[model samples]
Target: MTAPVFVVEGAVPGDGAYVLDGPEGRHAVSVKRLRAGEAVVLTDGLGAWCDGVVTGSEGKDRLLLDVGPARVEDEEQPRITVVQALPKGDRGELAVETMTETGVDAIVPWAASRCITQWRGERGLKALGKWRATAREAGKQSRRVRFPVVADAASTKEVAKLLAAADFAAVLHEDRDAPSGALASAELPTSGEIVLVVGPEGGVSPEELAVFEEAGALPFRLGRSVLRTSTAGTAAVALLLGRTGRWG
Candidate 1:
């Protein structure tokens, strides 16, 4: 099995005896049952990573590791950002988790005009926190050294500005007459940002689509069937990763 990955705050020693404690340590020692001599990994969740051997485990809540030299992975090219409109219920978190695992570079939560779920006041703050937490956990599970960033909620105008600045941009719309062919075959830049906008359950309002298009974002379709707002970003990202040769 692949060595499990755990997040670390602050600096991780290049190579030495490092204490793996606190909630992470408990998860490794007690929950994961990591025993002495087992292999593990530690990451700062920003590309810096180190392999470790579990040298000793304490009682039921912690462990120590013989950590190796830390190394940083260079950020991959064709950075993908998904502008995901708010979905009702916990599906926002679901979208975040899957998209993080699928290797999205960043996620922008948008409050589209037609969104049924609105993020307001404390509820908005809590929802954003949940999305970030879900991304962190999913990144660990997927063994990603660099976790995706969940930015502050954006408005339609802000989203349009983002698309206008991107090297390549696409809005995942399903209109037969509107969508431009398969996103997989679309020309993509090897470097720079590729932003994909996913609308709400009611889909992108005509006004929203016009704003995006005027910003130079073309409409693209993932497949024949219409997908839910929560799943569209993940599916689009998977295609992009494969097309960009990152999945190779």
Candidate 2:
């Protein structure tokens, strides 16, 4: 079996000994049953990683393997961001996980006009934490150097504000009259942020679409068939990544 990968807090070199802590530490010791001589990979979630061997397990978990030299790669092209409307139950978690694996640069939880599940009180923060954790694990598994950011839930108005700050923004609507073409085929700006907005289960209300349209977000269709909130964002990310030449 391949050695399990873990994310650390700081930048990693291709060679060196580093420490693991928190959940990663627990996994290395308790869950993975790693002993003091096994090899594992560690990443800083910013395109830096090291191959090292487990050196110690006392106190805070520590790895003493000789790290290879550091390698730094440019960030993914197109820098796709998915502004997904929060789905009920585990759907949001599933969406975030899949998007991470598919190479989304960031994620924003959107609360739209037709959204039935509103994240409020402590539940909102809790859910956000869970998604973040899921994203981190997915990134490690996919060998991605960066961990996708999960923004706090935003209302329709807040989403508009976010779009104003972005270079390219589009809202995925089923009612769009035009055929939803592949995002890769779309003429995107050479550089700057790209944000894709996805609606909730009930879908984006007419008013919400108008709000996004007024904010300069072009409406795009994903295809003839409607996709669940969970699948749309992941599918969009995969297309964007492939178009940007990140996917082989």
Task: Candidate 2: count the clashes.
Answer: 9
Model 1 agreement with the true structure over 1-248: per-residue lDDT tens digits? 89999999897666899988899999998889988889998999999999999999877777889999999999899899999999999999999999999999999999999999999999999999999999999999999999999999999999999999999999998763654447878899988999999998898988999999999998988887899999999999999998888888
User: What is the C-alpha lDDT profile of model 2 across 1-248, one tens digit per residue?
Assistant: 67677877766756555567677787777777788778787778877766777777755444445566766667766688899998988998999999998889999998786878778889888988998989988888876767898888887898988787878888888777866574546777756788899988887888988888889888887776889999999988777776666786
For model 2, give the 10-residue run with minimal summed lDDT: 58-67
Q: What's the CA error at residue 21 for candidate 1, in Å?
A: 0.8
Q: What lDDT, from 0 to 1, does candidate 2 have?
A: 0.80
**How does model 2 score by TM-score?**
0.87
- What are the TM-scores, per candidate, against the unseen true structure? 0.97, 0.87
Q: Ten residues in a row with the worst lDDT in model 1? A: 175-184
- Prediction 1 TM-score vs. true: 0.97
